[model samples]
Target: MQPSGTPSRRVSAFDIALALGGLLFIFLSAQNAGPAIAALRADGVQGTFTAQRLDCVEHPGHEQCSWVGDFRSDDAAVVREGIGFYGSERSTFTPGATSPAFDTGRLGHVYGPGGSNEWVIIAALLLVGLALTLRPLLRLRRPPRTPAPPPVPEHLP
Candidate 1:
């Protein structure tokens, strides 16, 4: 007879793939935490927010996504610039608006206390995801066991 109550789920390929992807994100983010903290400590120039763009394109042959923003540097005369690669964010900065430059005072203000705490939060969430993903596989390893019936009493018969 089938077990009553909740049914066990079979681990599928998609679950493994998703777990791997989540793990990859956690790993990558963990690796960058140190550097990010360092960068947060470093001094940076002030800039005014000029514009922000999140451009994405998809085609049969290729796909591309670009995230960038223009900031007006304040150290000197008016100059438009942006940063990328290791420190990049999807933002919405309107032209003529003044806002803190990302790598500089903005990050510290937004993240609060050097910005390292967020990484720990991300790791914890990913760990929960990892456990959920492994649950199905772990369940599959232990098959349900049925109890053997007791021997009939000869006297009763």
Candidate 2:
């Protein structure tokens, strides 16, 4: 007779395959789709904005052009701007006193502080860590087994 309350052993290959496929999709999506999605969301933000595209007028640089964008509302105004990569050392732009202070900090770089390559490296590391942590969780399948085979008689009449 089977135990009164114990659950039966059930392992389905279909279920496992479905789960693995989902995990793979998630991993690939995080790697390839995350940045584009993030940019889309940022662009969706509602606020008064100004943007300008600039190129290195002075000297050659790693980056060709930079985009400066700012967001503003009744409550506050925030600047979302960065310098593009240039082959030269660095460039700075100073608007007049009437204008809000918006500095790119450095040239030949994305977002003024660090370059696009830096962000890419950081994002890649984060994804790697996420995958390592989630892989076991996604791959979890079975619990420990306790059942044993019954004894067989040596001689049969």
**Alpha-carbon lDDT of model 1:** 0.50
Task: List lDDT for all candidates, in order.
Answer: 0.50, 0.40
lDDT of 2 by residue, 1-157 (tens): 2476445544367655555665665565566454433333332222333334444444555444333444343246433443232222223432211112222222322222221233454456556656655555555545545567788869977
Residue pairs in collision within model 1: none
Lowest lDDT 10-residue stretch of candidate 2:
94-103
Tell how far residue 29 is off in model 2, in angstroms: 1.7
Question: Deviation in angstroms for 72 in model 2?
Answer: 27
State in Å the error of residue 52, model 2. 23
Off by over 4 Å in 2: 5-7, 41-157
Q: Supply candidate 2's per-residue lDDT for 119.
A: 40
Candidate 1 lDDT tens digits, 1-157: 4367434556788777866776676676666555455445544444444444555568899866544455555665544455321222344333344445534433212221232344455557657666755665676788656556799878863
lDDT of 2 at 63: 49
Write down the TM-score for model 2. 0.25
